[model samples]
Target: MNFLYLLVVLLPIAFGVGWWASRRAVAQRSGVQVSELSSDYFRGLNYLLNEEQDKAIEVFLRLAEYNHDTVETHLALGNLFRRRGEVDRAIRVHQHLVSRSGLSDAMKTIALLELGEDYVRAGLLDRAESLFSDLVAMKAHAPSALRHLIAIYQHERDWHKAIEHARRLEAMTGEDQAPTIAQFYCELADRSRQHGARAEAREYLQRAFACQPACVRAFMLTGQLEAEDGHHAASVDAYEAAIEADSAFLPGILPPLLASYARSHQMDRAEKFLRSLLDRYHGVSPVLALTRLYRQRDGERAAIDFLTAQLRQRPSVRGLMALIDATMDKVEGEAHENFLILRDLTTKLLEGQAMYRCSRCGFGAKAHHWQCPSCKSWSTIRPIHGVASE
Candidate 1:
């Protein structure tokens, strides 16, 4: 009991000494007597630490009043509000800073940048873009503003603007943006191809390749355009180069490559290319392609035998589904009924599964994308190969 009394007595003394130390630390930092404001600051900090948000906001508001001339205080308060999703408050605070007549151009630029970020958070992208564009034009925080402009253009699917600003940013910053510029060109090429401006599409693809020597997207687009326009031989050449550049894209490339070869009646090349693909790629697409090639040349029985052997090695649900479908035609009675149920279950299993994923951000999708819509990274979304999936 005496020990408890001693601890209680020492606790207040310890707190008082610690308070003095804290005042000293703040005085050293702020170059002012924070002791007068320390009580409210500590109370606010305590509320924040304890997740008492309402009281914390009240304390910070008081701190902002006590430190009205302190730019750092206003910036910190606005950033805290922004982090808490109070973007309107953040925008208002940053706007006030930007409007302050005597503020340094550098400080005003910082506040404008923060305000632009707040506008983005609020999904007011048009407002954000204008502010950031102004900063870029003024050459104040140009690189950061140009990056934000590029992001805005990408989000808006205005690929041309993105390409222009990305190139400008590269020139200004001396950073390598070739990969991104190639992707932007690819986007333009795709749009041109879809709109039947085939010649223009090819021009953009040439630009993509110029930016990135071995750009897989440019190769793919070249193959696609050639194939669609009945230049099967050229299409095969481009698709082959696409695979050589990046074997990870073989699944997408091979389908078109094989189609082009078949269209040109080049069965020999198809076999040779697919065989080479299996050697380079461990994914099931090549295996399945090989199975079909065997089935076409030999017979159904040969295809079934080939698939069963490969499935033993890879064990895929899609392969199993194919195997089951192949076997169902020859089955009878309860065996056939059991196969039907199994097929249905497998179909359901695959129904909700994402067949592709963004390598950059792990965003899952049912369809493939040459560019990640989430992270805006190029050539990142790819086939998700596995047992119960693509």
Candidate 2:
């Protein structure tokens, strides 16, 4: 039962016991002691109702001391401290409870878990990790501890360890974690690529595909690696596959697609892919990219005409900047000066704008994060569709 329910039931019994004892005391001596105890109880209740937490804690602590067997009181007090962000005090309380001679194994593990959480909240990650590892080793609270350990490894950027723990969590809970695990493998591939371990990077990317066949990041990485090795045709195929995997990532796909098209001299295929993108993507990136392509192939006038027409359909700050750049070369005197000032103002307007946001937690970032920093949700942060961004 909850503490409040127990208190409601036991407080009346205690009051009756006190009253009967007071009646006996009256026969033996004066009523002074009974009146003092009654007044103290009322004072404690008044402190509770007033939300005078310090005084309430003082009263509760005294009552628990007087009634030494009250495990529920101590539990309530410990939970209160934890909720108040007094994690150290909560740890001490829970530790004391765990050390008690009569505590059940279940209660002891619960206290230990609470204390481990306190360690985590206090930024004592090593201590928290060790404690949670012990819980997992003992197979008590293994699922919760494994979840926490996976989160800790993620925070530490230990993707291999995170993947191991996540696997354990899935096994213990019988829950599917392939998508998240695939992202972890992608992280491993990215790390290997950064360290120039091409073989290891390819292996991890292959593992990511095994876990999630439509993993776009894996495809993008494969395409980049293929291009770096001068396999331009394969690179073009992989980039196109990446687009097919996740068209929501159009901004990231376009630059590489354009590069691959340039490398393979496949303007026809590039135009077809870009046209398909224009139908699906509301962002201005593909529009600007196509404008550049037109200007390079045809002329400035054709690009300008295309952009001016597209701007009416989807106005964008970046499109405006592109327009100014495209038109400014032909502009002269006061008009050029005015265009320069306008460009400067537009640059200022977009200078500090966040280009991505975590859909789950609303964490704004200049660059995208696969997992939200605030909420730790996977694949939550994406490019913001805006006048200033894609």
Candidate 3:
């Protein structure tokens, strides 16, 4: 069990044992020793209840020194130290417990797990990696050890090892790791693309699609690859496929898709696709993009008319900025100057606003992240449909 869970199971037992021992000591000795032990016990409990973990750890440490058999207390104390960000102290406590000759295999494994966590928190990832690898080989806490190893590989950007361990974890636990494995492939693709390894990147993207056929990131990357090779038609097709896979990534796919449409002389097709988005998406990006399209094809009046009508349905600061820019050119002196001031205010209003939010963790970001930076959940961040955002 994890240390938090161990605390839940062991805390009451520790208190019960302490109370019983105090009662027995009262029968044998003068009330002095019993009272002192009782006072220390209650003080430690009070510290824990008050969230004064440092003082609680000190009290528990002293108690563990005096009571040689209090392994549970030491475990709880070490866990508290780790949770409190005192990794060195936690490592010391767990390392001591791990070295004790009387510890059972079960307890030793648990202590080793906690010590591995301490090493991870201390940024001694190599040490933690070695310890967890040993645990996995022993098949004693294999799932937990494999999970830590996967996390280490992810941190190290070792996608091949990460994929191997993740598959092992899935085989052991019967948990689906397909989506995560697809993301690892995507990461590999991105790294390959960055280093100008087109063939390797394409191979990785193919693997990603094989793992998850509807992988939006894989489609987007495919579109990017096609675009980089000046294959606008293929890029447009890939971008459209990406949208079909996941419309939630509309904001992310739109810019490249629009550019590809322009490069391929497909404005009519673009209009139809964006018009379709107007029905499906609540965000104002497509609306703003369509307004610009109308301005370029028809005239300022048509664009203004379209934006004004859309603004009635979905009011947006960005739409307002667009409308002001379109209107400002026709006006002069006071009207144009006032419009400039209003545009500045609207721009400032949107300056620090988050355009995206993580559905899982409620973390707001100015840009989209495929994995939530806060919760590390995949495909959770989406465009925030609001007046100041998308």
TM-score of each: 0.86, 0.83, 0.92
Model 2 pairs in collision: none
Worst ten in a row by lDDT for model 1 = 30-39
Cα lDDT over the full model 2? 0.84
- lDDT, each prediction: 0.85, 0.84, 0.90
Residue-wise C-alpha lDDT for candidate 2, range 1-390, written one tens digit per residue = 377975786688678758754875676566665565555555666576667767867776776675555565677677767777888888888788878998777877887788788788888899999999999999999999998899889989999999999989999999988889999999999899889999999999999999899998889989998888888888999999987998777677778878988998988787777777787878898789889989999999999999999998898999999999999989899999999999999899899999888888889998767788889988888889877787
Candidate 1 lDDT, 1-390, residue by residue in tens: 376865676568458646764766665675354654666666766576677877877877887786666565577678878989999999989888888788888788899899999999999999999999899888899999999999889888898899999999999989999999999899899999999999999999999999998999899999999999999999999999998998877777888888998899988888888877666677888778878888799989999998998888888988888888889989999999999999999999889899889988999988788778798788899888789765
Which parts of model 3 have CA positions greater than 4 angstroms off? 1-15, 18-39
Alpha-carbon deviation at 5 in model 3, angstroms: 19
From the highest TM-score down, the ranking of the candidates is: 3, 1, 2
Root-mean-square deviation per candidate? 5.9, 5.5, 4.0
Q: Count the backbone clashes (under 3 Å) in each candidate.
A: 0, 0, 0
Give the top-scoring candidate (TM-score): 3
Q: What is the lDDT of residue 68 in candidate 3?
A: 71
